[model samples]
Target: MGIRTLVAMLAVALVVIGALATQESYKVFMPGLLQGAVLTIEIAVLGSLLAIVMGVLAALARMYGPAPLRWLATVYVEIFRGTSALVQLFWLFFVLPQFGVMLDAFLVAVLALGLNVGAYGSEVVRGAIQSVARGQWEASTALNMSRPQMLRRIILPQAFVAMIPPWGNLFIELLKSTALVSLITLSDLAFKAQQMNQNTFKTIPIFTLVLLMYLAMSLVVTIGMRLLERRASLGLARGKAA
Candidate 1:
């Protein structure tokens, strides 16, 4: 079986085991965790959108923009990708206010995770764009198409297919990283689990539930991305036929 299948099966099995192990405690914990999960999903959705935008912009700048823009994009990708994500979060949340830039906790969490993941995603974008055959570029040039026109009309639609799988991986990584928001005082799933554990000392059941909840969320993202990949592949095929 594929890794996704394995992960989903493992998560389901754990859920069953947890349910059998702690039937009563689940009733007490599920409500709070579900509430926190809503926030986690919200942050992840918004963060993924931002990451897509940043990744595309940075990749284009590095590949096609003027010298200054290329330099700036390179710097951004290097700094964000090279540094620790936890430190990045701390800088945004704890250090920024000292400079009179007070962002909301939710906003900071989104920014930190989005920008961090976007840095890696920029490389994915660049590689996908590069993976397009050289002959396609030559054909576009023969038609005297401008860079933007060629990219929008020919290259990107094709490159997008290559991008989807890697982007799916990045999205799941971003989802897992949402747990970091709890350290910034955002009441995400991990935070709720910790709060419940502290209050009742039910560490095993609470953390087990937390693991299953996260696995379920990641599986949902995996399924969504797979559907998207299939749709994009179909669209590309249709475009070629036309």
Candidate 2:
């Protein structure tokens, strides 16, 4: 058979094997799977909230601040983005205790995940803000609008509309990255999956359940984001028409 056919057959065989393995241990796997889903949801929600806050702040500082402040923001973003997330997590978890700053594993994970994703998300926020037309700024200034007034009344509303789609994508990424928190013993989905596999010696079934749970959660987030995007676009369209 051709290479393509051989790969397809291999994939089919793997799927069949996975099906058989999962069926054999469904009872033992289901509870841990549910627990893992809840943990994953918790981490995603908390981390995304922190990330959004940090991202908006970072973007604002970078876009509107003095040169020194802008440089600082740029450095922050680069450092986080440059390093591996696993190293950041380990440092936060292990190093902070030396300075008399002790954060629980969950908190450290949330902070690290938020900071890491925030660096990337800030670029999205900055781009969205910059995409707002220069004419809008000039018109606002012509109207004798102060900087704060222009930002609040004319700029932010438009920028927020543009930011939503990219923010949604970043949120999905934040969801997946929460898996790394497992390394710090946060008892999130990946952690629980590891625990289950270790205790039950049923690696395949446990991992399969965890995979399905992640897929299901990601699907929900994707659907929600699509609906939000549609709503945001529809609102903008209606306003333009009016």
Candidate 3:
């Protein structure tokens, strides 16, 4: 057999061995896994929510604000997107305490994840909002619509449709990024896996479980995003037809 085939066979054998080893001790893994999953989900959900809100605000600032305001928004986006999330997480957890600001692990994770993702999400949101044609803006103005009214009635509705795909993409990234929170003793999936491996000396089995759990969560997010994308498109089609 080729090297690739040999490697695949060895990988399969390793998985089988790991599974067999962990099978008898399933009860010990279950509680930790459940708790870890909960923490993972909570971090992803809360972080994504904060990211969506801040991203929208940032996008709006960049797209419509005064020159200095836009510059500030641009700087914020660039700074966050430029830095390493792990570094940011560490700062939030460790350095912030030195400045007389104390945050719990969960909050620190949420803040770091949200801030990191928001920078990327802002660009997506800004592009989506801008994708509404220039003609549409002029038409709204010609119809004597105020700026707020134009955005509300003519621009935002369409922009939201465009934003769905990018938002979904950000969510997937956010979900995976939650693993980094384990470093801060958050008891997330990675943390649980580490704990199991340390206690049981079954690193391979523990990590195999972690891999599967991350894969399962990612798949769920992917399917949900696809559904949302379809719904957004369907709404747009129906509106156009009407």
Candidate 4:
């Protein structure tokens, strides 16, 4: 079978093994882990949505906004991209409270990770938009289309296709970064694994399960992104033909 098929089968095998573990073991571990996994999924989904919004807004601001807006967007992009995500997390969770700007741990996790990933995503968007052929811009202008009209009708749809692959990579990176949220007391998958390991001392079994769980999640993301890319590509092709 193909490599993807093999990996998928292996993940399924591991999941089956987890399910078939002793009742005591299953009861001890599975509930907590599944709960954490749910929370992790929640965080990833919210963070990804925020990241997409921020990336697009920042990219548009930097490219087309007035001087003040461009400067602000530049500062945001450079600061977030230049710093460590961990540091950003710590600052949001630990340091912000010092200014009486207390925030919920979950909120901090989503904001920190979303903003960090978004900084990189902004660059991807900028590059993809730039990659669209200048001829398309000229043609749109010749049609007497306004800047926003041209961008909406011609430029963005094409750039969106080019943006998909890099956005996929950034999303995967964002998924991995969710582990850091555990440090701030959010019970994500990594936090659950550590808590289980400490309580039961089933180091190998617990960690191995955690590894498989993360792999399963990343695989799902990869598959979803690939499907999205394929669908976008087909749409782009059709658009070109028409």
Candidate 5:
């Protein structure tokens, strides 16, 4: 009856339409698409792990550590963020071979994805940490908590709540960006789709299939992150109650 209800119904109808369309598209590219989809997931998951680790470390160094540490973090973030991700992959995959620094294609893809996403992610981390209240820090200090203890016990848990939404967006972006790895012969979703188009000449349907596959993957990430956010929020609530 109301506008909110109407909007909800419209959204549901759109989802149903999309689902039906994807079903038709899936028949056009089935078994050939499976391996590429799997590899895409594998790359995205591992790359995201590396990205989170780097982002957190870089953020902490820039925020709380010594001047030299801050400078190093700054340089790392700036270099990766300033440069193109494709260029980073090219250097790692192509140029490095000349210097005998060759890496496996999968490894190169993973590292490039991680480092580039991590650079942008560092700012998210820094901002989340900064968002935690000053009073919380003072309270932890008043309790004679050590720096590490305060960070582990008080600061990080709260910062994590604020970090989830941005990190979710970054994760999905990283997943989509995995398509680039196909450029270097990684045989991911995009590459597989390219092959389908080359042989079948059904670019529209094949790419439509790829789009649905990516959308499915993104949905999974969104749902997982939502669960994580709920858990983090509950944990924060408990910590505050204590």
Candidate 6:
């Protein structure tokens, strides 16, 4: 299997080399587009982190908070998740100033992406938390652990372990959604590709490269998430063991 994999990799390398050899021009358009790609990653990482925090907060509120807090959480989740993400971005970037709440384009993009994705993530968090066994909650109660303490030390750790895979999907979705920032004038991966296409009129090669770049970025996210999943699963196992 190792040798087969090695040969397969070599074959792909040769193909890429042959393509690059034929079109050394990929270097010429890469700089500006690559800058946009970097910005896309920055947005994705920040947005994903913010979304995760919002998700957990909202999920907890819906699950265990007082009635008003739960209602607020439900309202937030419904409004954001039901709306079109592109419209949300437009409203933030274009309309907020009239209402005296102006944020810069980049900040608006980040907030839009994070909040939109977080709405969906709230459902994921809710499901994961609810999936935990009732016995764990009873056991925590029997041990005299407070609600906050029990969630922090027992429920969240287990729920987070289960949430990883779904969270990974949400992360990828958030990453792809960053492309829409281009519509609001924030330079991102898709925006850069569009710029390259306009300048060079090489739409095929430009978008092909764009496809590969997204694939590469998604692979990186997938691998990182897989490692996290392993670590979380190990921690969960150890907790159960002890």
Question: Global lDDT of each model?
Answer: 0.89, 0.79, 0.83, 0.87, 0.86, 0.84
Q: RMSD in angstroms, all models?
A: 3.4, 6.7, 6.5, 3.0, 4.4, 4.0
Model 4 stretches astray by more than 4 angstroms? 1-27, 235-242
lDDT (Cα, 0-100) at 179 in candidate 2 = 90
For candidate 5, write residues 73-113 as lDDT tens digits.
99999999999999998889999999988799999999999
lDDT of 3 by residue, 83-198 (tens): 98999999999999999999999999999999999999999989988888899999999999999899889998888878886888899899999999999988998888888888
lDDT of 2 by residue, 1-242 (tens): 33355345545554654574457456666666678778878878988988888898899899888999899999989999999878999999999999999998888988998998899989988998788889999999999999989999988888877777678788888889889888887778898888888888888777766776666566566656655655666756422321
Stretches off by above 4 angstroms in model 3 are: 1-22, 235-242
Q: Please, what are the lDDT tens digits per residue for candidate 1 over residues 114-169?
A: 99999999999999999998999999999999988999998998999899989999
Weakest lDDT window of 10 consecutive positions for candidate 3: 1-10
Question: Between which residue pairs do clashes occur in model 1?
Answer: none
Q: Candidate 5: TM-score?
A: 0.87
Residue-wise C-alpha lDDT for candidate 6, range 95-190, written one tens digit per residue? 899899979888998999999999999999999988889999999999999999999998988888789889989999999999999998888889
Best by lDDT: 1
Off by over 4 Å in 5: 1-28, 235-242
Candidate 5 lDDT for residue 182: 94
How do the candidates rank by TM-score, highest first? Answer: 4, 1, 6, 5, 3, 2
Model 6: lowest-lDDT 10 consecutive positions: 1-10
Residue 30 lDDT in candidate 2? 68
Better of 3 and 6 by TM-score: 6
Per-model TM-score versus the true fold: 0.91, 0.85, 0.86, 0.91, 0.87, 0.89
Q: How many residue pairs clash in all the candidates, one count each? A: 0, 0, 0, 0, 0, 0
